[model samples]
Structures are given as C-alpha cells and as structure tokens.
Target chain A: MTDVASKEQKLSAEENISSKILTIYLIWSVIISVSIIIVGTILFIVTGKSGYNMENLNSLITAKGSLSTYPFYIQSIWSGVLTLKPFAIIQLGVLILLLTPFGRMLLQVFIFLYEKDTTFAIIALVVFAILLFSLYMVNILEALHIA
Target chain B: MIYIVIGYLMEILVASIAAGIIGALGGLGGGVLIVPFLTLYFHVPISLAIGASIVSVIATSSGSAAAYVRDKISNIRIGTFLVLFTTTGAILGAFIEHITPVKVLFFIFGIVLIISVIPMLKKIGEEVPNVERNDPLAEKLGLYGEYYDSVLKREVKYKVTGVKPGAAMMFMAGTISGLLGIGSGAFKVLAMDLAMRLPIKVSTTTSNFMIGVTAAASAGIYFFTGDVNPFIAAPVAIGVLLGAIIGTKILVRIRSSSVRKIFAVIILIVGLEMILRGAGVI
Candidate 1:
C-alpha cells in the first residue's frame, strides 16, 4: 500500500511540474504569436502590400499550381527572417505556433529523461524525431533531389 | 484600396472567430469552419483555405490545451502515445493532398463530418460509461487518469481499452486532418470515447491536446508549399486563438450532453453544405 501511495505521489508531482511548464509555454506561445501577427498586420496595412501581391488575391491562390514549386516559400521565409519583413514576421508567427507542440514534446523528452522514465523518454524522442522530419521533409527531399 | 483591404481582413477575422468558438464548443477544432467559410464564401482557393485552417487549428489547440492541462482534464499520456501514429499519418496525408482534386477533398470532408455526427447523436443524453474491466494494453501503456469534475463535484477515474483499435482510428483521423487541413477532432473523440471507452471530457480534452501535434506535422508541408498566405493566416490564427480561449473557459462549466447535441447539429449542417458544394449543386 505504501508503495502504491509513493508511486501515486510521484506521478502527481511529475504532472504538477509538467503542467506548470506546459501552461507557461502555451501562454508565451500565444502572446508571441499574437504580437507578431499584430505587428505584421499593422505593417501590412501601412505598406499596402508585403512581398506578395494583395491587389489581385486570385493570383495568390495556388490550388491548381504545381506541387514542385511549393518549397519556394521557404526561401522567402529565410530572407524574411533575415530582413525582418512584416509578412515574414507573420509567417514566423505561424511557424512558431506549429512548432509549439514540437517544443512541448522536446520538453517532455528532457523531463522524462530527468525522471529516468526510459519508456516515456523513448516515446517522446520518437515523437520529436517525427516532428523534425515532417518540418524538414522539404529540405531532405531537395537534398536527395527527389522532388 | 486601403478600405477594401481592411474590409477583407475584418471578414476573415470575424469568420475565424466564429469558427474558433464553434470548433472549441464542438471539440471539432477551428479548421472545419474556417476552411468551408474561406472556400465557399470568399472564393479563396482550396489550398490556401486549407493552409489557413491548419494554422488556426494549431492556435485553437494550443490555447485551449493550456487550460485543459491546468484543469487536469487532458490525458497527456494517451495523447503522447497516439501522436506517434497520428504524426506519421499526417505526413503521409500531406503528400496525398498534393495529388488530390479539390472537389474530392470537399466530398471526403463532407462525408467525414456527416459520419462523425452519428456517434454524437446516438450518445446524446447518455451518461459517461463506467469501464470495470482492465485491458492489458492500457495497463502496459499506463493509459489511465483521474480528474476532478467541478460540475459533478467528484473525482472521475477512467481506464482506456482497445489501444490497437484506437491507434488505428487515430491514424485515419490524422490522415483526414492532414489531407483536409482541419483538426480531425470528431474522429479522435470517437476513437477515445468508443474504442478506448474513455469519458467524454477526457476524450475531448485529450483530442484537443493531440490536435496541435497532428496539425503541426502537416503544417510544415503546407508552409513549404507556399500555400499558407500570411495575410489570411495571420488574422485567422489570432482570431481563433482568442475564440478558443473563451471556449475553453465555457467548456469547463457546461454540461457534456448539451455540448454533444449542439456539436452534432452544427456538424450536420456543415456536412450537408460541403456535400452540396462538392457536388456542384449549390
């Protein structure tokens, strides 16, 4: 009975710590995303159009476009970050939002390792790897010249 | 020109806010409403609409997940285990989206929405199931959790079962999410509520948590493809995030049965509309 009690205590303690961290991460991610989006929106309004053409919204739609050209945006993303364009800042916000879960998984990996929970650590690691692969699949494919 | 741009932004913002609220209340996530609205009303291309919707899903999922976690309602373990399958499925689904026709995607979306409502309709007014038997899979994976229900004023403990089947269903859910650029919350809830026999609250919260990772998996592909328009996605993300925050607050106070019925009716309408659009009848 004592063993079960201690186990439950440990689990709750772990949950408490992780939940606190997750809450902070979630709040910060939202703030950062919203801030960037607001700044981007303001800049977009002032500039009348960011790098992309807004006058003719129809041309911007890529529904029937070739899939091979999809990675072209990544180049702009790099330049946008380097130059600090409002559009790129907005894109960066979206990227950050997408990466938030990935960040949580990374934190879980560390937490699990610190707790010496090998099973969960491995699981978290696998999740982290899959997310990394998905995020970088375009670069990988390009490196392999498969696309 | 400035007025025109502002007008467009306001429209996207309002629509996204509505989608976010409805999505959080329904546990379906924001993508379902945002995608249909952008495509049907604004004449936004399917790919861009989908890209924007996926981004909004991340926003809604993360914003609400924080509240759910703090409340101790979301099952982190189950969500983590399922991510392994859902993420893999999402990647495959993203590739498939590249070749799929827009009309076909709409048809599938409509079909999925309609089918998911059936389970919700059947379970209306039903009490949460009590699972007395222990499944070996759940035991091995440590897939059980306890949360205090403020509405009921008691602690609810739930043990998950049918791990294999739930995981399989999650893969399909992830596939749909990735292909359609929506949070496949309906199917995720189904897999947990039915296959795993979890409580509805646990199922919904866990599904919400899992959605961020699932959408993230496909979002990268969409981003690289230049399908994510900054102009549309930015406002949508901000609006949905705000709406999701409000929805989460309401979720904790509302009865689960009412939420289910409302979710069913909303999905039923959206499903019919999508079908009509896809069939070129409207």
Candidate 2:
C-alpha cells in the first residue's frame, strides 16, 4: 500500500537523521491520537452523564484555581490529576499541538536541505512563510480584539 | 442515547470532510463555516461550537499536513519559527475568553472578519507573476521558496521579507481563532501576500495547510472542558464539511475574484446580524 518506489527515490544513499526523526514523529503522532481517542472514550463511559454540563465545568475550573498553588507533590501527584480541569489541560494541549506544524515543517526543511534538494526546500519554505504570516495575523487580532 | 451518539458521529463525519476540502483548497478552517450554523440553526451554545470547530481544525490540519509534507508543498523551517509565537498567543487568548463578555466578543469578531476580507477583495483583480529579489533580506531571513501548482502545471518561485508586519498580523489571526474559532483564513493570506509579498497561491496553500495545527492546540482545551458536545457540533461539522468540499470543487472553476465580493457581502450581512443581536435590536 505504501509508495515504496517514491519513498526510495526520495531518500538519498546517506542515513539522513532528519527523515528518520520525521518518520518517528509521524509514528508517535498516530499512536498518541489513537490512545487519546481510546482514553477519552473510556473516561466518557466512566463519567457517565453525571455533571458534564456547564455548571459542573465552572466548578471544575474553580477547583483548579484552588488546587493549582499547592506544594509540588500535592499539585503534581494529586490535584493535577484529580482536580485537574479538562478545559485548562485540553486547551494547553491543543494549542501546543497547533504549533506542531511549525516544528514539523522545520523538520521537513532540514531533511530536504540535507538531501541537497533545493526544489523541495523551496516549496517547503513557501508553505512555512504562509504559516508564519497567518500566525502573525492571529497574534495581532487577539491583541487588538478587533475581531 | 444511542440515536444521539449515531447522529453526532454522522455530523462529525460530514464536518470533517468539508473542513478537509476547504482547508486543502480554500485555505481556511472548517470551523469558521461550522460555528455560525451551529449557533444559529442548531441553537447550540457558542462556546461549544467553538470547541468542536477547534477539533475539526486540528483534524483538517493533520489530514492536510501529512499530505502536503509528502507532496513537498509545506515549508518546515519557516512554519516552525512562526508557531513559536502563534502558540503562545493562542494560550493567552484562550484565557482571555474568561474575561471578555460573550456578546462584545462576537461583535468585535464580526467586525474584524469583515475588515480582513476587504484587502483580499482588492487584490483579486491583480494577478502579477513576478518574484521579488532574493536579496540580503530574503536570504538572511530565509524566506525564498517555490511551489508546483497542479492546476497551472508550473513551478512558481518567490522571495519574501518583512518579518515584523507578518508577525504582527499573525497575532491578529491567533486572536480571531481564539475568539471566533474560525482560524482566520483570509487574514493569514493577507499577511503573506501584503506584508511578506509572497505569491497568492503559495500564501493560500500554506495558510490552508497550517490552520489545523493551530485549531488542534485549542481543541484540546475545549474537549477537556466538555465544551465539545458531539451532538450539535456533529451536524454543523458534517454540513460544513460537505459544503466546503462542494465549495472548493466549484471554487476552482468559478471566478473567485467575484466570489470574494459575495463572501464580503455575506460577512457584512452577518456582521449586521451580530450587531443587532449585540444591541438587542434583533
């Protein structure tokens, strides 16, 4: 099913670290996505229909505030898991993942450059530039709240 | 319960497809297309709609990014640096929602969206095929690049600079995404074309490409908070996913220059609706 010929044609004779690393990253991403879906499903079943509404969510957030400043052990070992609000945790995760493309893109560039393939590097760069600019726009709009 | 789950699943399927197509071709988040419908027709809460849209954005990004990287359409180095700032901004913006009033936020969101589309409309008529120089600015900053357009069947090369304005514009795009859950597609295009002076095709492709990652980052938070009610978001996501796919296929054949006007008009109407709603005039 995989494009073996195309893959072989792209990869040079050298043992390129960038391509190897990227392959690892892609594998990890798939694993993480699947695991999260599974875990989330289990949590949904365990939680049942109890207190999933907005009111409970607000309470969860408030509880987080109270528990956040506890000592390292309490905050990390107990409160972080037990009172750890989903919104706060999920928001941090999603946003961090959102920035993954930038890193992924950088990895692509390093691979292309290592292969001495200027053409692919150029294309990768163009796409990266657009991402950068789009990011810049997001920053400005948020700061100004001009909507 | 079973019916609700089935219905929700169906909605997400549709939304995912629509977001994927629009994200691939039109270079915008599928969420922008989904949220308004959810809030207006489905009577879903705005917060929940935003959350679902965020998830779809991440999905779209993942789908497209993998393909684009394989096709050599995305640039990693530049994309990486930009994310450093956008992610920070997204984290901060998500928290800001806690402080801002819902109505006021939407009003501002509607206004900014309208303003963002105007410049795109203005540039639609001019199709200049020229690359700026790879001078000290482009070389030192490492912004020179190229892409192959399947439609045009040609390689397009480009040079770009103006990092300051581009970064500044990204800040605005991040804010809009956090506020409206739309991923601010047009604003992203504007920053690349206007500030960095990249080709329109390149700008659209990259913007279309990176939005998913940005959306995913925020989606995680919404999911943990239980803001993502699959029921409401499912229908909206499905409808938009279908709509966007249809829109993208048609967009290629139709004159997008003129469509920009239509899009602008739609946003204007929506803006007025939002204003009326905000003012209790509805």
Local distance difference test, each candidate: 0.82, 0.53
Docking class of 2: incorrect
TM-score of chain A of 2: 0.52
Question: Could you tell me the TM-score of candidate 1?
Answer: 0.94
Tens digit per residue, CA lDDT, model 1, B222-248: 877677877788888988887787787
Residue-level lDDT tens digits of model 2 in A1-147 = 369867655553432456357646644553354343333333433443212242332332122211232111223323323544332233333333444555566666767788776765766665456555554553454476532
Q: Least accurate stretch of 10 residues (summed lDDT) in model 1 chain B?
A: B125-134
Recovered fraction of real interface contacts per model: 0.65, 0.02
User: Which residue segments of model 1 deviate by more than 4 Å?
Assistant: A60-75, A81-84, A139-147
Per-candidate TM-score, first chain only? 0.75, 0.52
Candidate 1 per-residue lDDT, tens place, A17-52, comes to: 978988999889978977887887888778776654
- C-alpha lDDT (0 to 100) for residue B225 of candidate 2: 41
DockQ of 1: 0.54
Query: Which residue pairs collide in model 1, if any?
Result: A70-B225
